[model samples]
Target: MKVAMIGAGYVGLVSGACFSEFGHQVVCVDVDERKIRMLEQGEIPIFEPGLEKLVADNVAAGRLSFTRDLTGAVADAEAVFIAVGTPSRRGGGEADLSYVYQAARDIAGATEGEKVVVTKSTVPVGTGAEVRRILAETNPGATFHVVSNPEFLREGAAIEDFMRPNRVVCGVESKHAEQVMRELYRPLFLNETPMVFTSLESSEMIKYAANCFLATKITFINEVADLCERVGADVQAVARGIGLDRRIGNLFLHPGPGFGGSCFPKDIRALAATAESAGAPLRIVETVNDINESRKKAMAAKIIDAMGGDVAGKTIAVLGVTFKPNTDDMRESPSLDIVPALQQAGATVRATDPEGVREAKELLTDVVWCEDAYTAMEGADAVAILTEWNHFRALDKGRMKKLLKQPLMIDLRNIYPVDEMEKAGFRYVSVGRRAVGN
Candidate 1:
C-alpha cells in the first residue's frame, strides 16, 4: 500500500515510519522545508525513543521517504492521511481544524485515483464529514472515501503503541474504504490486533473520550494525593489497592504534579467545548481541566512552602523539566507552570533535564540551565523533582543533601519515599503521602 502522510509532526512522522516498517511505501509530507531537509539529511526533528532508528532503517530499505511536495506525494498514493495538528483554538477551547482543512483542499486538488483520505489527526466529531464535503466541493467528480482513524500513541512509547496497540479504531462509511483500511493494517490484523470499524463520529469521539478519561484518572489521583497529605495516608497504597480491582485498572493512577502533555490537556478542553456547543455539557471534563490547571500552580506553591514560604532570594533547583520521562517533549510540561511560579515567588531557579533542556531553554528563560542534576542542585536552598526520569529515581540522596544549602526536597512525582529521604537526613515532601521532616 502506498500512503502519503500529511504534516510530518510527531503523529505523522511516527505513523508514516511505522506503516513503512509494515512494508508500505510511505511519503511523509510537511510544509516546513527545513524539517524536510533535516529528515532528508537523516536528522530526526523529535526525540522519540527508537523513532530515529526505525525511520533510518525504513529509509535505508527505500520504503519510507520525506518530502515538502504534498501534491506529488498525494497524487500517487492509495491512502492519504491527514495527520496534521489540531491545536486548541484560541478563545473557544475547540480544536483548530485549519490544518486539517488545508490538507483536505490540497489532497483534493492532487488526488488522481480513488483514494482513501483518512483523518489520522484527532478532531471533533463530524470533522470527517466536513472533510468529505470540502473534497466534494473542490474536486466535483473525484471518487474518494473520507475515513476517521484517530491516533492513540503515547509520547514516550509512541512507536510501541503504534506497532502493538491494544486495539485499532477505524471509522469508515463504505465497504471499499473499510477493506482498504483492513488490508493496510493487515500486519496488525495477523497479530490479532482487533480493529473496530464504526461510524466516523464514533471513532472521533473515541479518541477524545479515551484521552479525557485518562486525564480524569490523573486528576483523580492528584486530588487523592492532596487528601492523603492532609489525612496522613499513602496514595501509592491506595492506588495499588484500587488498581488491584479488575474493573479499575491502575494505568494513569500515579499521583504527580499534574497531567501535562501534547494530548490530554488540549483534548479535554476541546471535548468540553464540543459538548457545550451541542448543548450537552460535560461538567466532569470541565472540572478536570480546571483541577489539572490549578494542580500545577499548587505544586509550585508546595515547593515554595517547603522553602520556608519565601523563595525570592533562594536558589531553587528543579530536577526534571519535561512533561514525563523518556521523551524530550516539553509541550505543556508542569515545569512550564512550576518554574515561572518559582521565579515569581522570588526564587532563582536552576534546572536540569537529560533531554528537555534544549526545549526548556525556550519555555524557561529566567532560569539558569545547568550541566547535570548535581550542577543544578549545587548551592541550592531546595530541590524539586518535577518529572520522574530514571536517573532522578536512583539519585545519590546523600550527595544531593550536601549540594543544597537547606536540604529541602519536594518530590512531586513521588520518586523517593518518605522513609528513604528521612534516612538521608533531609526534609522530604511528596504527593499523597506523609511528609518526612526532622
Candidate 2:
C-alpha cells in the first residue's frame, strides 16, 4: 500500500509512521517547510513515546518518508489521508475546517487516478460531504472516493493505541473506498481489531462522542470527589467501589484538576455547539465543559486553603505542570489555569515536569522553573502534585520535608497514601479524601 498523508502534525506523523511500520509505504506531506525539513532530517517535532524510534526505524527500512510536495506524493499513492488539525474556532466552538478544505482542494488537484481520499482528521458531521463537494468542484473529471476515518490515539500512548486499537471506525459509502481502507488496515485484521463500518456522519460523531463521554466521566468523578470531601469519605474508595461494577469500569474515574488535552476540551465543545445547531442541545456536555473549566481554577483554591487560607508571599512547589503523565503536550492543561490563579493570589510558583517543562514554559509566565522535582520543592511553603509522573510517585519524604518551608503536600492526583504522608510528619490534602494533619 502506498499512502500519502496530507499533514505532518501529530495525527499525520504518528499514523504515517505506524502504517509504514506495518509494511506499507507512506509519504507524509506538510505545508510547513521547516517541519518537513525536520522530519526529513530524522528530527521529530512532537514528543510522543516510541514515535521517534518508530519513524527512524521505518525510514531506515525505506518504508516511510516526509515531503512538502503533496502533489508528487498524491500522484503515486493509492490512498491520500487528510490528517490535519481541526482546532476550535475563535467565536464559535465549531471545528475550524479551513485547513481540511484546503487539503481537499490540494488533493483534488494532485490526484491523478482513482484514489481513496480518507479524512483521518477528527472532523464534524457533514465534513466528508463538503470534502466530496470540494473535490467535485475542483476537479470534475477526477475519480476519487472520500472516506471518513477518525483517529483515536491518546497523546502519551499514541503508538500503542495505533498498533492495537480497540476499534477502527471508518465511514464510507462506496465499495472502492471500503476495500482500500480494508487493505490499509489488514494488519490489524490479523489481530482481530474490530472494524466499525458506518456512515460518514456516524463516524464523525463517534470521535466527538467518545471524547465528550470521557470528559464527562472525568467531570463526574471530580464532582464526586467534591462530595466526598464534604461527607468525610474517600473518593478513591468511592471510585474503587463503583469501578468494580461491570457497568462502571475504572478508566477516567481518577479525580484531579479536571480534564484538559488537545482532544477532550475541543471535541466536547464542538459537539455541544453542533448539537445546539441541530436544535437538539446536549446540556450534560455543555455543563461538562463549564465545570471542567471552573474545576481547573478551583484547584488553586484547594492549594490556597491548604496554605492557611492564603498564598500571599508564599512559594509553592508544583511537582508537575502537564495535564497528565507521559506526555509533554500543554494544550488546555490544568496548569494553565491553576498556576496563573495561584500567581494572582500572590503565590510565587515553582514548577517542574519530567517532560512538559519545555512546552509549559511557553504557556506559563512569571514562574520559577526547576531542573528537578526536589529542586522545585526547595524552600517552598507547600508541594502540589499536579501530574502523576512516574518519579513523583515515590519521593524521599525526609528530603522533601527538609526542602520545604512547610511540610505540606497537596496531592491532586492522589498519588500518595494519606497514612504514609501523616507518618512522614507532613500535612496532606488530597481530592476525594479526608485531610490529614491540617
Candidate 3:
C-alpha cells in the first residue's frame, strides 16, 4: 500500500511513520520546507517518545520519506490522509475547519486516480460531507472516497496507541472504500483488532464524544477531589474504591489541576458549539469546560494559600511544565495558568521539566529555568509538582528538604503520598485530599 499523509504535524508525522513501519510505502507532505528537511535528516521537529527512532529506522529501510511536493506524493498514492489541525476558533469555540478544507482542495487538485481520502484529523460531525463536496467542486471529474478516520492517539503514548489501537473506526459509504481501508489497516487485522464500520457522521461524532466524555470524567474526579479535601477524606483511596468496579473501570479518574493538552479542551468546546448550533445543547459538556478552566485558575491560589496566605516576594520551585510527562507538549498545560498567576502575585518562579524546557521557554517568561528539579527547588520557598514526570516520583526527600527555604510541598498531581511527605519533615498540600504536616 502507498500512503500520502498531508500536513506533517504531530498526527501526520506519527501516522506516516507508523504506516511505513507496517510495510507501507509512505510519503509525508508538508508545506514547511524546514520541517521536511529536518525529517530527511532524522531530526524530528516534534518531541515524541520513540518517534525519531521509528522514523529513522523506516527511512533507513527506504519505506518512509518526506517531501514538500504534495502533488507528486498524492499522484502515486493509494490513500491520502488529511491529518491537519482543527483548532477551536477564537470567540466562537467552533472548530476551525479552514485547514482541513484547504488540505482537501490541495488533495483534490493533486489526486490522479481512484483514491481513498481519509480524514485522520479530529473533525466535527458532517465535516466529511463538506470535505467530499469541496473535493468534487475542485475537480468535477475526480473519483475519490472521503472516509472519516479520526485519530485516537494520546500525545505521550501516540506511537504505542497507533501500533496497538483497541479498535479502528472507519466511515465509508462504498464497499470499495471499505476494502481499501481494510487493506490499509491489514496489519491490525492480524492481531484481531476490531474494525468499526459506521456512517461518516457517526465516525466524526465518535471522536468528539470520546474526548468530551473523558474530559467529563476528569472534571468529575477533580470536583470529587475538592469535596474530599473539605470533608477530610483521601481521594486516592476513593478513586481506587470506585475504579475497582468492573463497570466503571478506572481511567481518567485521577484528580489533578485539570485536563489540559492538545485534545480535550478544544474538542469539548467544539462539541458544545456543535450541540448549540443544532438546537440541542450539551449542558454537561459546557459545565465541564467552565469547571476545568476554574480548576486551572484555582491551582494558583492553592499554591499561594499554601505559602502562608501570600506568595509575594516568594520563590517557588515548579516541577514539570508540560501538560503531562514523556512528551514536550506544553499546549494548554496547567503550568501555563499557574506560573503566570504566581508571577502576577509577586512570586519568583523557577521551573524544570525533562523535555518541556525548550517549548516552555517559548510560552513561559520571567521564570528561572533550570537543568533539573532539585536545581529549580534550590532556595525556593516551596516546591510544586504539576506534572507527574517519572523522575519526580522518586525524589530524595532529604535533598528536597535541604533545597527549599521552607519545608513546604504542593503535589498537584498527587504523585507523593501524604504520610511519606509528612514523615520527611515537610508540609504537603495536594488536590482532593487533606494536607499533611499542616
Candidate 4:
C-alpha cells in the first residue's frame, strides 16, 4: 500500500513511520522544508521514545521517505491521510480546522484516481462531511472517499500505542473504502487488534470522548487528592483499592498537579464548544476544565504553605517541567502555570529535567537550568517534584536533604512514601496524602 501522510508533525511522523514499518510505502509530507530536510538526513525534529531508530531503519530500508511536495506525494498514493493540527481557536473553544480544510483542497486538486482521504487528526463531528464537500467543490469530477480514522497515540509511548493499539476505529461510507482500510491495517488485524467500523460522526466523537473521559479521570483523582489531604488519608492506597476492582482499572488515576498535554486540554474545550453549538452543553466537561485550572494554582499554594508561608525571596528547586515523563514535549504542561505563579509570589525558581529543558527554556524564564535533580536542589529552600521521571524515583534522599538549604520536600506526584521521607528527616508534603512533620 502507498500512503501519503500530510503535515509531518507528531501524528504524521509517527503514523507514517509505523505504517512504513508495516511494509507500506509511506511519504511523510510537511510544509516546512527545513523539517523535511532534517528527516532526509536521518534527523528527527521531535523527541519520542524509539521513534528515531524506527524512522531511521525504515528510511534505510527504502520503505519510508519525507518530502515537501504535497502534490507529488498525494498524486501517487492510495491513501492520503490528513494528519495536520487542529489547534484550539483563540477566544473560542472550537478546534480551528483551517489546516484540515486546506489539505483537502490541495489533495482534491492533486489526486488522479480513486483515493481514500483519511482524517487522522482529532476533529469535531461532521468534519469528514465538510472535507467531502470541500473536495467535491474543488474537483467536480474527482472520485474520492473521506474516512474518519482518529489517532489515539499518547506522547512518550506513541510508537508502542500505534504498533499495538487495543483497537482501531474506522469510519467509512462504502464497502470499498472499508476493504482498503482493513488491508492497510492488516498487520494489526493479524495481531488481533479489533477494528470498530462506525459512522464518520461517531468516529470523530470517539476521539474527543476518549480524551475528555481520561481528562475527567485525572481531574476526579486530583479532587480526591485534595479531600485526602484535608481528611488525613492516602490517595495512593485509595487509588490502589479502587483500581483493583475489575470494572475500574487504574491507568490515569494518579494524582498530580493536573492533566496537561497536547490532547486533553484542547479536546475537552473543543468538545464543550461542539456540544454548545448543538444546543446541548457538556456541563461536566466545563466543570472539569475549571477544576483542572484551579488545581494547578492550588498546587503552587501548597508549595508555598510547605515552605512555612510566603515564598518571597526564596530559591525553590523544581524537578520535571514536562507534562509527563519520557517525552520532551512541553505543550500545556502544568509546570507552565505553577512555575509562573511561584515566580509571581517572589520565589526564584531553579528547574531541571532529563529532556524537557530544551523546550522548557522557551516557556519558562528567569530560572536556572541545572545538570541534575541534586544540582537543581542545591542551595534551594524547597524541592518540588512536578513530573515523576524514572530517575526521580530512586533519588538519594539523604543527599538531597544535605544539599537543600531547607529540608522541605513537596512530592506532588507522590513519588515517595510519607514514612520514608519522615525517616529521612525531611518535612514532606504531597497531594491527597497526610503531611508528615511540622
What's the TM-score of every candidate structure?
Answer: 0.99, 0.99, 0.99, 0.99
RMSD of 2: 0.8
lDDT of 1: 0.92
Cα lDDT tens digits for candidate 3, 1-438: 999999899999999999999999999999999998898888999889999999999999999999999999999999999999899998988999999999999999997667889999999999999999999999888898989999999998999999999889999988989999999889998889999999999999999999999999899999999999999889889999999998887998999999788999999999999999999999999999999999999999999999988989999999999999998999999999999999999999999999999999999999899999999999999999999999999999899888889899999999988888888888999998889777
Model 3: worst 10 consecutive residues (lDDT sum): 107-116
Which 10-residue window of candidate 2 scores lowest in summed lDDT?
A: 108-117
**Candidate 4 on 1-438: residue-level lDDT in tens?**
999999899999999999999999999999999999999999999999999999999999999999989999999899999999999999988999999999999999998768899999999998999999999899978898889999999999999999999899999999988998998899997789999999999999999999999899899989888888788888988999998888888988999999888899999999999999999999999999999988888889989999988999999999999999989989889899999999999999999999999999999999999999999999999999999999899999889888999789999999898899999888899889888788
Query: Candidate 2 lDDT, tens digit per residue, 157-186?
Result: 999999999999999989989998999999
Error of 4 at 10 (Å): 0.5
Query: Looking at candidate 1, what is the lDDT of residue 145?
Result: 97
In model 3, residue pairs whose N, Cα or C atoms come closer than 3 Å (at least 3 residues apart or on different chains), thus clashing, are 225-432
Which ten residues in a row are the worst by lDDT in model 4? Answer: 225-234
lDDT of residue 375 for candidate 2:
94
Which regions of candidate 3 fall more than 4 Å away from where they truly are? Answer: none
Instruction: Give model 4 RMSD, 1 decimal.
Output: 0.8
lDDT of model 1 at residue 435? 82
TM-score of 4: 0.99
List the candidate 2 regions with Cα displacement exceeding 4 Å: none
